[model samples]
Target: MRVPHDDGPPPPPRPPKGRKRPGERAAEAGASDMSQEPGRAALSPTVAGGEAGESLSLRPQSLAEYVGQAALKRKLEVFVRAARGRDEPLDHTLLHGPPGLGKTTMAHILAHELGVRLHLTSGPAIEHKGVLAGHLTALGPRDVLFIDEIHRLAPTVEESLYSAMEDGRIDLPVGEGTRARTIGFELAPFTLIGATTRTALLSGPLRDRFQIIEAIEFYGDDELAAIVCRTASILGVPVSGAAALEIGRRSRGTPRIANRLIRRVRDFAQVRGARSIELADATAALLELGIDSEGLDMLDRRLLTMIVENFRGGPVGVEALGASLGEPRDTLESVVEPFLLQRGFLLRTSRGRVATMKAARHLGLELPPGWQGALDL
Candidate 1:
């Protein structure tokens, strides 16, 4: 499908006869307007060496391209089709919940389905009010501004966005020093697509500003298997169906992890005098990588061990646990913690992190001090 280059109908009147032709003026005008948009040029900035022509954007493009989250796909399709028909943005969509579940890719798909340009950037990239204003100023009507990790938007920068999202207006300083006055610039009716793994950190007002809150849930066995198989095919790896399902079962419900595992397994198979991935070879390869059949990596098991042994299988604070295990809090929280918690291996208490009975029993360990009381409750 062709991208919608025309945001709307052409400017009504041509330039005067003495002036440059309307087409040249239009081109110049577009160039001038586009200069203010970050990540909005004809080319996208290098993401994980995508500048080298590698498929670093990694995320899929459509619901069919997106694996898993079937319910989300159904809802998104309705919203996409309806929004497209009305010629209005879908909404100020906020994608919450854990990472690596195609939140960013879904945003791109939403933009693509709407036939609008997708301007990508992160929350931290816009440091000041002016920078945020400039970015919004450059957006065409009904364009998409994807702000990844939206919970990290600084207070001042977030403040600058209130009016932008609410009224499609941005306040800019017209002059310097005492002579300066704030000027309100009208913006196109655009969509603010915010994504975050940590929705709790967002202010209440900020959360309310979003028109929709869609949480990306973990993938199921079938979804993960299909994702692995499809991803392997796309990367030109010869993968057996069983091997694909095996990899997916071990992917811990994450498509990104499934893709990563496929690559690792492919590498292993290539070096081990094998041209194709079979169940046995895949199992052995995964064993070497320290990813078990349960989809738990060695670090994941180590984290469980830390919780079971060092933290006493009870209420252990994340900071204290991270310090003991040398794990970054955010990484532990976003990647490892989500899977563990989802698998019913860990419990989040009002006090702190506690290993579930399943976790203790899985490790063949006894429950520790504090958990005994909570278990009774």
Candidate 2:
């Protein structure tokens, strides 16, 4: 991206009819700017139009407003302060972790603190070299370009970012045949903020370009309780500490899920004409939504039951599991599997997914006949 210059004079008037102008023809060919498509516009950290019906009003807009991730916050604070002290853009940063843990919120807070306009896009939004070149060329000095789900970026598009990150330039091939040549254009010094749910899918070369790679951790129950109270206060939905604690315990250690549950429970409370959410209300609301005391929803229980009964708790491939559940493999891997694996209810073996004995006991189901010989049963 070219930085606008203050010393530049205004362009001359358009030429007379039938007399072609030198810059007019070039401007016609290259003046079109990038479009703000729906996907790109929805990438903002604000919860408005976010996945799972989360409200942007509930999202924390600053570092102080953000909850949990103390260690990562401290590291980022020092890093941001140092960069601001030098009056320079922050270096490329990569945030990796499970979804709904405040990675997007942190990126927004960083740009806000630096007093720069943030450009939001995702890996799937940018396609081909021309589209990427347009975005990079539009950046101003010290601007922030946030790319969510960066692991999904096409390999060719990811490679195009290499030069932009390392050298502040992009080499574009112009013309064809004998006239074809690579043109290197300098970009304004800018920051690239990448967020990903799965870091393993990112290439080593792309991962190494980032100066700071931070992993966001799941929030503890107490932290989630505080988040619940904070969100309730913001949304004007009264909630008692006891009720908040109960909701937090079943939130799967995710703020997004906690906030979502709060909305549902609040609706129940309002319908009942109660002043505030109580323990019973929280339980009833979550149960109605299929979330249990252990935070295992119906799908989770179904997964466990299927493995125990049909597969005999033996190893089974994810494809077969998804086929049985009628869900896409990616959905199960990214959303359901993580929490199940974290809680040790499910194990991934070389062969496939194996149901653990703990899972059976949690569901109050007896082991199948002759199940004792099953691996890890």
Candidate 3:
């Protein structure tokens, strides 16, 4: 179906013509307007910093092209259609979940489906009120402003958005001292799309402002395998279904990692002079990368090992674990622990993190007898 144009009513009068727009000035100032970050692990489900360009190209442009999140996709399709039909901007939306589940991509797809421009920024990127104002004022009618890691926005900056999101205007302080005065400016109607991994960090008021809230779940292996194949196709590398599935199985249920792994596997296949990727190529590549059959990587194993060996099959707190492992608590909670918990290798109890019996078996370690009974496992 043809998407309706976003040109509903003319936008409110914009700043005088010749004066550079806030968006333009912000762009020139190098505001954190980028969609993805840099320097993250290839296996991380979050956008890999090093492969931003490739990731952008691999991203599905429309909801139909997106894989996984069946329920979310259905909801978004209806929402997008309804919004477009009404010639109105979509309601403010908040997407929260673990990273790498395509929250950013979904934002892009929303803009694409709505036939509107997308303005990208992050919570931390809006360091102050001025930066937030610049981004807010830059939006055109029906445009999408996607703020990734929205939970990280400073209290002041986040509060500044309340009025803009609710009433389509902002009151900013101008001048200094006795000359200081508040100026309220009317803003063009637009949609705000906020994504966050730590939803709990968001203020209640802020969370309540979003008209639509959806949680992104991890992809199923089948969905991830399809993503693998799609990425391989986009990279012009031939991949067998079996190979794609194998990569997907080891992808920790994340498309970013699946895409990243396929690229590495392709490298192995190319070096071996193979015309296409096969199961063996994927297996060997993953083995060389130290990702086990269960998708546990070095860091995962390290965390498990620490719990098993040092903490005696831990009921250890995350803080203690982080201190011992020399890793950040946030990294442990967000990245390493989720997959382990999902795969039954770890458990979180009132006491702390506990390595499960399955984890002990995987590590080939013999836990003390009666330990399972004590832990009530």
Candidate 4:
């Protein structure tokens, strides 16, 4: 979304008939300018290398192309077919998950399946009521508005969306002083797809507005291997099944990470003048990138090491750990902790985060005597 430029003074409240309005011209300009910006406005975040990157993006344009989240895909397929049969917009959907699990890709697939235009924006991008209003007013019937990181929306901006989402209209105050009056503008039917990593941060009313709430889980290793193979095909690189599986195993169960590893492995193979990616190449590439067999990167290892060594096997607070590591608490909780806890390296308790015995073993650290009793192990 483009913020209109100020040129001395604002345009007249009403432009002469047959002439374009300032707002219309600004919107047109924004549309044209979108191509110049790589990762802004309606452009997919996963896209890189500008237009070339868009063609190579691993994002699935349809549910048939999307991998994993099998149950969610089946549900969406039924919903899309039903909505199309009734000639109505799909219900507002809330997709919650950890980052890079294809929440954004799912939104794109929804729009494509419904055969509608998608307006992409983020919670933090819509700063106020006017920005929200601009998006709402510009929609055509059955179009989609995808908001990423929806939990971060400003309260006032979120409030403005209630009527639009529920009533298909928006109420805005017009004029000023004693002449001030409220205007309600009717809007076309539309779908709002919200993606968030932190569902608990959303207001109850906002959460209730969504008709379909789906949780996107991490991909299984097999599913990730399939995604890696598909990505390699898209990149025109040859990859062995064993290489793909190895990359998948080290991707931490995320397709985005799997694709990234594929590209790095391809680069490594190309540098070595190898004809195709092999298990040895994949292993060497990941090791060179500081990823261990357990898929733990340097940061992950550092977190575990800090807990085992500095915190004495950890019954430590995330804030304290963040302070010592110079990392944000949110990053620790959202990014590092989830994977570690999933892999049994860390445990969350009422008191704080604790390093499990598995973490000590992984780090090759020896706990003091009687540690089992102290940690209730």
Pairs with backbone N, CA or C atoms under 3 Å apart (clashes), candidate 4: none
Q: Evaluated with lDDT, which candidate comes out highest?
A: 3
Per-prediction TM-score: 0.81, 0.83, 0.85, 0.85
What local lDDT score does residue 16 receive in model 3, on the 0 to 100 scale? 90
lDDT of 4 by residue, 1-27 (tens): 988987678755777888897788998
Error of 3 at 302 (Å): 1.0
Question: Model 2 clash pairs?
Answer: 47-56, 48-56
- What digit string (tens of lDDT, one per residue) describes model 1 on residues 1-377? 97667678867786677798768789879967875655442322223432233244456777777777878889989988988889898789999867778878888899988899999988889888888887898899899999998888889889878888998898878889999999999999999999998888988888899988889888898898888877666665678889989999888888878878887787777666565788987899999999876778887888888877887776788899889888889888888888988887778888888777777666677765566423733
Write the residue-wise lDDT of candidate 3 on 43-75 in tens digits.
222233436766778989988899999999999
Q: Tell me how candidate 1 scores on lDDT.
A: 0.81
TM-score of candidate 1 on Cα atoms, chains taken together: 0.81
C-alpha lDDT values of all predictions: 0.81, 0.85, 0.88, 0.87
Candidate 2 per-residue lDDT, tens place, 1-377, comes to 98888887978887898977877677545533312322221112224353344576777877788888888888888988999999999999999999988888888999988888789899999988888898899999999999999999999999989999999999899999999999998999999999999899999999999999999988888999999999888766678899899899888888989988888888777666566788888888888898988899898899888888888886889999999989899888988888888877898878888888888888887776666324454
Give me the displacement of residue 351 in model 2, in angstroms: 2.5
Error of 3 at 313 (Å): 0.6
Candidate 4: segments with Cα more than 4 A from true spot = 1-56, 372-377
Clash count for each candidate, listed in order shown? 0, 2, 1, 0
Between candidates 1 and 3, the lDDT winner: 3
